[model samples]
Target: DCEFLGIVGRNGSGKSTLLKLLSKIYTPTKGDIEIDGSLVPFIELGVGFNPELTGRENVYLNGAMLGFSNQEMDAMYDDIVKFAELPEFMDQKLKNYSSGMQVRLAFSIAIRARGDILILDEVLAVGDAAFQKKCNDYFASLHGKQTVILVTHSMENVMAYCDRAILIEKGKIIEEGEPAKITEAYLKLFNLNS
Candidate 1:
């Protein structure tokens, strides 16, 4: 049941849209999507976070949206803050946080929460280099152990982590195969479309 699948495409190619459909954040207009497992989607990280609220408040808020009870959120609060590396800033307003900080905080919460299938949409593109490495390592560790749907522009991620890959163009899957072939085809799109 565990499959590490990668989706790659240029901007506006429906990569994020595909993730949304899979996560049920968006309903498909013409097709049926049958997901066999529960999934935690990290789409547009920090989408539910309020700029006016403190990071701590946002954590609870975000957690609640993800179906966590207050007690559940309380139990995981410390670990989430620690993982975000923003223990000191938890009490501060989210608006004060940098984009990187916001993303890290969102990512931390998502990682700490429970889910069988993890759907990530460009979540690897943010945070500092070290944090990126941490995420990379986390994804690597998930290989063959968790069902992960990764939608990234990073070909490096596809090559390193994906067992199979698909290339989407104009809201449709144009190619599907091994990571190397999909990546190569994806790169060629730019030259051809340019």
Candidate 2:
């Protein structure tokens, strides 16, 4: 959201909350968070999803949250499972699904719903190595076309995906710059690399 928007910091640095605030999932205590366009927050897809509901049902529900209608979701149904690679279990209740499956479905839905601003948490890590690579590839394909904010503890991944990183400490920004330098500072400041 700034000149250098990647965020890195120690535990409890309000990084998640910051994304929550920007996505309107959490209200700031003092100031109103402002963004000029449509915003979508990619949270854990299983958090509020009904486990008893089939993957098909969950797709529409998650789509609604992302501002898509049933017809829209229907159009994207095949794409979602293809991206998630769980086409075989599309009719099963999500409760019968594994955590990875749930995450896959959730992420698939999130990825399909277009937005002007996209905020991604660490939820993508729930997938296996192969799926993570797929997600990364999809993210790269969207590079510079849509405004994307990625939140993660993996400095290497952040460095690879983002051009700039911002360091936050205890709810306030402490530093901001190119991904390499800012991540280095964050690791040293937090003793993360040691």
Best by TM-score: 1
Q: Please provide, for model 1 over 73-178, each residue's C-alpha lDDT reduced to its tens digit, 9 standing for 90 to 100.
A: 9999998998899999999999999999999999988886678899988888779999999889988988888999999888999999999999999998999999
Please report, as a residue range, the 10-residue window in candidate 2 with the lowest summed lDDT. 1-10
Span of 10 residues, lowest total lDDT, candidate 1: 107-116
All candidates: TM-score: 0.92, 0.90
lDDT of 1: 0.90
The positional error of residue 25 in candidate 2, measured at the CA in angstroms, is 2.4
* lDDT of model number 2: 0.80
Report, for every candidate in turn, its global Cα lDDT versus the true structure.
0.90, 0.80
> Over the stretch 24-52, how does candidate 2's per-residue lDDT look in tens digits?
77888897777888876775555568988
Choose the strongest candidate by lDDT.
Answer: 1
